[model samples]
Target: MSIVRNIGAEYQPGKGTAFTVWAPKATQVELSLKSNPQTRVPLQREAFGYWTGLSEEAVPGTRYMYHLDGERDRPDPASRFQPEGVHGPSAVVDHTSFGWTDATWQGLPLDQLIIYELHVGTFSAAGTFEGVIEHLPELQDLGITAIEIMPIAQFPGSRNWGYDGVFPFAAQNSYGGPEGLKKLVNACHGHGISVVLDVVYNHMGPEGNYLNEYGHYFTHRYNTPWGDALNFDDAHCDHVRNFFIQNTLTWLRDFHIDALRLDAVHAIYDTGAKHFLQELREHVGQLEEQEGRPFLLIAESDQSDVRLINPINKGGYGLHAQWFDDYHHVIHTLVTGEMEGYFEDYGKPDQLQKALEHTFVYNGLYSEHRKKTLGTDATANPARQFVVCAQNHDQVGNRMLGERLTELVPFEMLKTVAGMILLSPYVPMLFMGEEYGEQNPFLYFVSHTDTDLVEAVRKGRKEEFAYFAAKGEAPDPQSEETFERSKLRRSYTSDPQQQKLREFYKALIQLRKTHPALAHPDKPHLRVKLDSEKLVLHLTHTGQEPHLYCLFNISNQPQKTQLHAAAGPWKPLLHSADTAWGGPGADIPEMLQQRATVSLPPASVLILELFA
Candidate 1:
């Protein structure tokens, strides 16, 4: 059956509103309004375990809840606006009321997407969706084409990473509800920036999750890190699948979201003939055809399975792109020289070269961390199919103190890391405050009302960071101070060094957009060579005219390397070690000949354009 779009309270202009909810477990369900609790309307139970009713008095501003079997009152499973909190009544939202200014915005192609991921609360001082809109101009000026926002679904409190969202449809009350989110999306499109929302579909948050009371939303057949897994393959799973599919459509159709970044797809266990991702992709494709615009699905998976991004006709899930952490792992380990937990599987200089040429370094190889063969060869996939980054929420926030790369690495190494990520043949993403050197930590935090649940979260965080126990005790996840500390200081303009770093990032972004070799992801014509002894990486992009030669010196000492370029004069394009960029000095000559020996400065990167 086709998916239903109007699952919750859908308001009609002249003809009141219609409410539909899935409640298979309840024999009787009544709609109770929050404004007047005495007024109750009984809904008729429809086939396939759904309740439907129409209320003339239930206006757009009316807040309501579903009373099941005259026993319990719970918020709608598909709430659009949770004004009070996750535990409060859901408000009726008039999606048509908001006037959007982006009618001409179609969307950006995968090749042209330079994503900047940010958390709405920490991104701005106001800590609301409108607050994020305030910085759209600054982001556009930085050459960002899209912003991948962390999950904003209705979680418990105002301060959170947003992964514990319980209401799939409702926008968080603290971050400014549904209307606030719409305004931000509308503003983003107006600025020619596509919005990619991070969504959690594997499991609901433990605190205010009421889906189990409505129907068989979770199953014991499989287990996830959050206990019972979503019922994607179990019995009575069609309705549950429809619930999520409708949520996807609501965002794309109603909210005008350009894409969705599915958080942690590895935790989603579905063994059906048609996997949940495939079904969701099919629905999204149908919407794309109807809307005449592009809609993308980017998955975050640790499996490194090519099937996730492979075409459905080729026996795969057919997702557009995925977060490729192998590249980040190799780069982080090489720069930090710290091998703990999953970092044990990385750190070889050859692996960095492999990740640049090929997508994955552990393709069908036994992983020292997993103790088993993991991943498939991803060389067949296009480079744009992988979204790589130097640092992200998981890479930074997962640390004991949530220290960013700026705090972990030196100033020169920071420039080198930016060069490696932006110049590589893939879609590049930058975490918030990464453009400049924001020193504040992006720690894990939560604000659950249940004392026991809060304690459990604190204990889980401590155990998660057991590898870094010697770094001192982790900050309390339930503390408001932790969330406050994660906020960006926005000191790039005031701080001279940070301003220089920001300029360097802008220059790299411009190069990525304008340079022939960096503009396109021609993996077949890209060649990579690594010297583990000298800690130097040489990359040649020969796909386009006037081939480009790149060098990265990751060592602390300068290394002399031979430039194996074509028999022509090569002009220096961008040198990270140039004195103009706060580096010591440029050691390479102004003009380079073929097979010329040049000194590469310590912790520096150089890009040269070959001229025939």
Candidate 2:
């Protein structure tokens, strides 16, 4: 064994690179440069698994593999990027080689962003970074300000949700790997749209995970439903924390990404004094200061803890935004009447009014899902709060039969839900294929190298539905067919149903952007009136430049009632009941023509902007 392990190796601007690994237990580790016949160069190690070597003579295009224990060569555990597939060898890449034209590019602000979340593999037919660019014009035209992609980190297979990523820095080779991502970022910035990468720091994918050999990166002390928890608080945690921290910065700086959406932060187990999130926030803030623009860190957490956005001076992690699951639940329940499962706590028209009013339903209120009161005092900062159709991803895929909301709710009901979702005071997000109400379902599927793990996933899915076992029908989650069916039906534009849904979404988003009451995030002054026939909610922005939004979440029966809120100059911009355009068939007529004393139809959702 050699005496030195160069953790920080010397840099070569464009030439082939050198790498080192730290494997204390291993007797020998060799660096195999994949050139000509793929020759193996021996490595030297230090005391604590710090293996070092130099490939000064290797070319930039050479594909190299790390051979540990003097046996078969594996990919680098800390590979900066993956060009080939995950199973292939790690190629030498120069971080500064890619020319970026974003010198004047600052970044996107939190509240200003209308984010569209997409999974690269299914986003386009090509399923590569280049393929996604072809669809960028569609996103740009849709009035989206940023694109939030599911993780692209190298996993075991050609496709995944990216939460299972083990190589934190390496981009998935199947999705244009590293170089392709840089190009994507450049293209986005050129179009003045930011890219927010959805990253998973909670747990690594079970397959192609070689972190166990590199260092103490995972722990068995704390168990997660998904195998082992990441090592953030345990032994040798300082380095482990640094590992992830560095990874975040690399994504921002190296990949030219504007923001990171931390996936399932509720699952990130940390107990440090300067908590991991706080540290990450501090670093990101500093980077923003250096870059001189808005760089964001949004967290996907069901725990509606206000401290996540509290400034460091106030002892909070200072995340820019958070995904509000309550918002989605409220909308889902109202539109679909899905009273089973978690939807049991939602579906009431009042819940819709409350979510828009406060941004959280369970704000210390009793939750049937948790079987307890949830959240603390968050009424203090409702604007900084983010609410959305955020229960995307798993919500669409986890269904026993893998179905989307389009499968349940009528198109106009979907449009009404869209009005409420987009017009609310909090930030809004749309899931991939949701804009047009695509019929494909995103299912829970994985290609694990371990056969036993495959069977285990199958059994887990079958038993998960004892609540619906009485139906005597269960989805076959194990079959490759299940995975195939879950892909989005891309023929949305040509399909009549999808075309109408797309038009509805387009109008709703446009209304949100143009209308003053719906554009900003502020808890509006609210008046609720419910009679035997209908429920009407009148909303007014509280502060300066106040505006109004009125909703009639009525039933299928026509009714007209007087509202209690102060009469203001309100014009009906939209009504869900007028369903000549592919929705729940209800026609509330133009009796609402610029007048206070108007009519309402059953099961209608209406929006009228007001000026007081």
lDDT of 1 by residue, 50-159 (tens): 99999988899899999999988999999999888988999998888889888889999898999999999899999999999999999999899999999999999788
- For 106-166, candidate 2 gives per-residue lDDT tens digits of 8866667778888887778787899989888888877787888989889867756677787
Candidate 1, residue 184: the lDDT equals 96
Q: Candidate 1: where is the Cα deviation over 4 Å?
A: 1-5
Question: How far off is residue 569 in model 1, in Å?
Answer: 1.3
Cα RMSDs, all models: 1.2, 3.8
- What would the TM-score be for candidate 2 when compared with the true structure? 0.89
